[model samples]
Target: MSEPLVVPEVRRLGPARLTAGMDRWDRLDFAAHRRTHGPLPRASRSELLAVADRIDLRGRGGAAFPFARKARATLGAAERSGRAPVLVVNGAEGEPPSVKDATLLARAPHLVLDGVTLAALAFGAAEVVVAVASGSAAELSVPAAIAERGRDPVPMRTLCVPDRFVSGESGALIRAVNGRAALPPSRPVRAAEGGRGGVSGRPTLLCNAETWAQLALAARLGPDAFAVVGTPDEPGTLLVTVNRSPRPPVVVEVPAGASLAVVLDACGVDPGAGVLVGGYHGAWLPPHLAPDLPLSRTGLAAAGGTLGAASVVALPRGVCALAEITAVAGWLADESTGQCGPCRRGLPETVDALRALSRGAGSASAVRRAAALGRGRGACAHPDGVARFVLSALTVFAEDIATHASGSGCGLSSGLTLPLPRQAGERLAVDWARCAGHGLCASLAPDLITLDPHGFPLLRENANLAPWQRPQARRAVARCPALALRIGR
Candidate 1:
């Protein structure tokens, strides 16, 4: 049976800057938005960069890259190229453990759009394109918001992209804006340099929904006001997706250095087994340390966890954590774009080894080996993120690993607790004993397959294939000459 997610509720530690009027209303239209957030402030490149640096403004996307650095790079590129810059609003919230970006975009879109407008003005951007996941509430609301401000000063429009996990990548979003396949390009150019030449080959600036909303807040409130609530180093309120199953993940706003335990407790989660600090790409915190850790990046890092996208998940004591990790590892393998070997081959192989460890059927060394194989090897950071998540589980649940490895099992069942869209039980695996290395499957589906050094196929296991890649995956499966490749669910 599938684990069901409860509908999420928007929560806060106190009155918020970004989520200003969200408590009284579900969403803000143009009139309400204007009333709630007064007028959007204008900013120069120097002024914006100064404010960003003073407040330590960073991208809310996984990397948490410094916004001022990216802004300067994009602005510098635009000047050198003598071409007007373009701005992309990344609202494609592909991270399964996260709902913060979508929540902000759906509830307070004007805040995000205001940030976009401010960024456009500072960069002298000729055009601005908003990217939202197809079928998401933001898809409808964003365009409507654009229509509301009919005579757009910067020529804004919406592009509904595939709602797949990788579709939110900066390169992928850029490609979708440029009228191409919504997949990350093999050699992804920085958005600073137009990122696959976005919107008619000009330099581009891209940031997620939360990043933009935060920017708007930073501009409205100077560094001192912004610094009031958060810790000294990390200032401002943050939106987090707290997963306490049977109830969907709650999208809550908390002060920068708030107590992690309190947030999880508010969401009715018991951080007994382990707590996943940052979504699937994040690390698992040991039970003892879970409650005491702070929600800031430095705080979590000290506890051997990452505040990646702030997707906090608390694992209940009842479930087998190893089983949960294995299942999630398997799902993450399925979510890979298969753009390179580490993602296609390494990720699935890592999950297999992890599963073996979970069941006491394999050595801890094996899990370590498979998980580490993809380090610094992916075309993107997807494989590395998966590796971090799996490895952390191994450390946090070492006692369980030893218990399971004894050929005796814990009494707990492997029932799901974390929220995953689907395909945790499926995989694409290669049976080495069954065949010769013909490499035909790779030829059949280059988009989804690649050849290893020995000419063996490296591809997604039981790929919950993307809409466009399914046909290719099927064709490759049918054409495998050695029949070594098989997908099982």
Candidate 2:
């Protein structure tokens, strides 16, 4: 399958670090990459570890975990087990709206390779595996980049996995590389621990594409130089996926402490509709605090948000917030693999509650409660992520939720701003000619259908289904007494 690799529009605060050379949209070839960033340098394990510490480097793949500490733990485990470590580069970007990782793996492949080579050499890695989405452009781009570097210090191979959310989990990624199912293991295990669960049971160091790129930049710039751009505690730059929704997301580089308000204004997004600080697993920034919030992990945390994967989405005025939230929630629910009790049962119910709340028939507390049920019960972070996303939406857009639940809906259609693999656009319609006005449909789908004084089911104009509403709408159709309720295009 041929997937279109849409190169996102690029923006930068001061100077472009990650997106250094290419004056054009072309991928930076080996020659161009070397010419632009100079030759890749070598570093000892201790040297690289000190560099990570000096820069306070954090992984860019949602968690913002300290890369240096993670590296130390991996190194310690490898030494204790008398096994050389394995290096794994995770380019299996599962977030549909995010292209930050893809931007690095597909465009500036050498920059990321430089970091990979450095890490592999430092830790004496046995082999390196690069995992990308099966049909994504990275599938082609990464292998081509490896071929360019013919005589790498570490032997390299690229494996492809389905680009699903859980497929990016550490254990799941390693499993996929070893030709096993790309699902999180039943027991929790870190790649560093290297049980039989991780790739080939050897100690492994797994980090996302952006984390490697960040390391490459830090190595090239040195500590003081790298610290010049960002905040006191957090240095270096961030590869932010700025969502211009309904259009391709823009991948921008901003100094770590750059103001969220400034980034939004520069990106031409008005945050009157509220701003999402992190990607889907992240929280919505309160509208009042967005202007003052910084882009670092600490800054967002202070404002009740996490800078997860650094995706910033500013909803436009007049779009239905509830509808957009339902779209993403529905996607998250589908991605859950029933790995645990709450994750298996809670996510779907959370989506249903959110859909009803959007239609003015459910309480905000019910949606939050359903979402909270999954907070810490899953074996992985899927349930927790879903809870964080839905609960934040309920808090950040409280006014919108109140308005919708009060039946004075904003009357705006779903902007379709949040991208999804499939748009469930089916609408609920009534076969008025066959209607006996028994009001059974109203009882069945009170969120969607209301009974008029004349006992006919009333639907809003252009009553299209958000992704989460399809199940309820279908059930109402099946159970309608007069055979009056139907769902269609």
Candidate 3:
């Protein structure tokens, strides 16, 4: 493959007070705030909504739903006479491979808090909840920043819950805060409909941390000012996490319409490789066609990818794409909360099929089974993510799959380039041959590993375990007498 392309790292107009005065930021650390371009103005709900409509502020969360639409939805849902709406700063950076949220929470906590406060003030919210999963650096740094607000504190509270990826979703976070499992419930109830804690359940305004930071900027600079940097429809700088490329990843403030290829080139991504436009759930596109593709949602959708949370991961050419996809599928199956049947059964079936394919033992039936198993099998997008990741692998690396199946590897020296989840379950894999078909691994780690009908092991690969649980997992690993189990890196 040609040497990875060197893309220029583009900076936005100004590194305002949000990111601290630092030249750049790691995933986390609140060092100092950039000099505020101006004061924080007090805008009424309608005014803020109007500003959002004019600037076309879409949810920076991968969905890219129009901010105005969400605001209007909340406004329309409010009761005639009741407590104001609730605002939530979704600091839960659930995407395992992406670290952009942690970066904002740690470095620009104040900015995000400011945006949540402003949203609360505008909407007349009774309270603002900065929901973060426990152990996240955000849970600590953000609260400290909120505490600093003192008497003038942003009517905000902190919610530190479990760190599961789906738990970060607006509704899931709502349930988790209410003391439910950190899993998204079936059906969608906009946090706006039943206010988080009010009688009429005033609408809840939930947005990504980076989204809030941009809103803070937009509120200060006005719609026109914010629009100056990005594309007309997708205005303003988007915070993104670029990874697996030649250059170290960064939280770049890329302007909309910047060529995807140019940005990757600037970031020093491998050339002639498959690019993961979104995060793990994102599609795979060949790098050649991405050069002229714009960076907005529409642009990426046109190019057959989602701009996700701006996770641009470049997979080197030599790696087995199927193996990587299957590995991720295996992880997705592990991450399931097991509340529902489809996700519990379907995800593993999909993972097994993918594993079989990766081992070059799967035939057409295996491919069909994998595809079918991935469809609509989870409480949230976990199953869909695994499916898309697998489907894309099948399409992008068709030749590689054929070769691997023909008793040859993909001829790549590199191992799995895609970052895998690092947790207890992922650290354990069953040795098919070594097992006396023992169901002990399944019984001992029932929350994660399960027993197949044939007395073999069925494991959940992406389950996130608490740090303390590592010892127990080690015990499980040690007890596999046949030495049929191993934890992945």
Best by lDDT: 2
Cα misplacement distance, residue 4 of candidate 3 (Å): 33
Order of candidates by lDDT, top first?
A: 2, 1, 3
Question: TM-scores, in order shown?
Answer: 0.88, 0.85, 0.81
Instruction: For candidate 1, write residues 1-489 as lDDT tens digits.
Output: 022222258888866777788777677788888899888888888999899999989888778999999888888888898988998899987877888888787778889999989988887889988899887778777877887766867889899998878888888888888888777777647878763555678888888889888889889988888888988999999998987687767889999989988888887788878888778889988878866889998998888888989998878887888888887787777667677888767886787677666667886778889999989978777888888998888888888787788768777878887888754343456788976888888778775577889987766433455344566767767777777776665
Model 1: per-residue Cα lDDT at residue 115: 91
Cα TM-score of candidate 2: 0.85
Candidate 2 weakest ten by summed lDDT: 460-469
User: Candidate 3 on 1-489: residue-level lDDT in tens?
Assistant: 112212223244333334434355332222334343344678888888888888787777677777778877676676553546777777776766676776777656777776777777777677778777577667667777776656544456788877766767677777766677666777646676774432235566678888888888889888887787777777777776777443446666677777777776666666455788778777888767776777788898887788877777777776667666766666666566655655656666676666666666765357656556646755566667667766776776678778767666676644666766554443566667777876677656654577777887766544444333355567777887788877664
Candidate 3 RMSD computed on C-alpha atoms after optimal superposition onto the true structure: 6.4
In the predicted model 1, the residue pairs found to clash are 6-248, 427-461, 427-462, 428-461, 428-462
Model 3 score (lDDT)? 0.67
On lDDT, the stronger of 1 and 3 is: 1
State the C-alpha lDDT per candidate.
Answer: 0.81, 0.82, 0.67
Off by over 4 Å in 1: 1-7, 195-199, 423-473, 476-489
- Assess the local accuracy of residue 483 in candidate 3 as a C-alpha lDDT between 0 and 100: 80
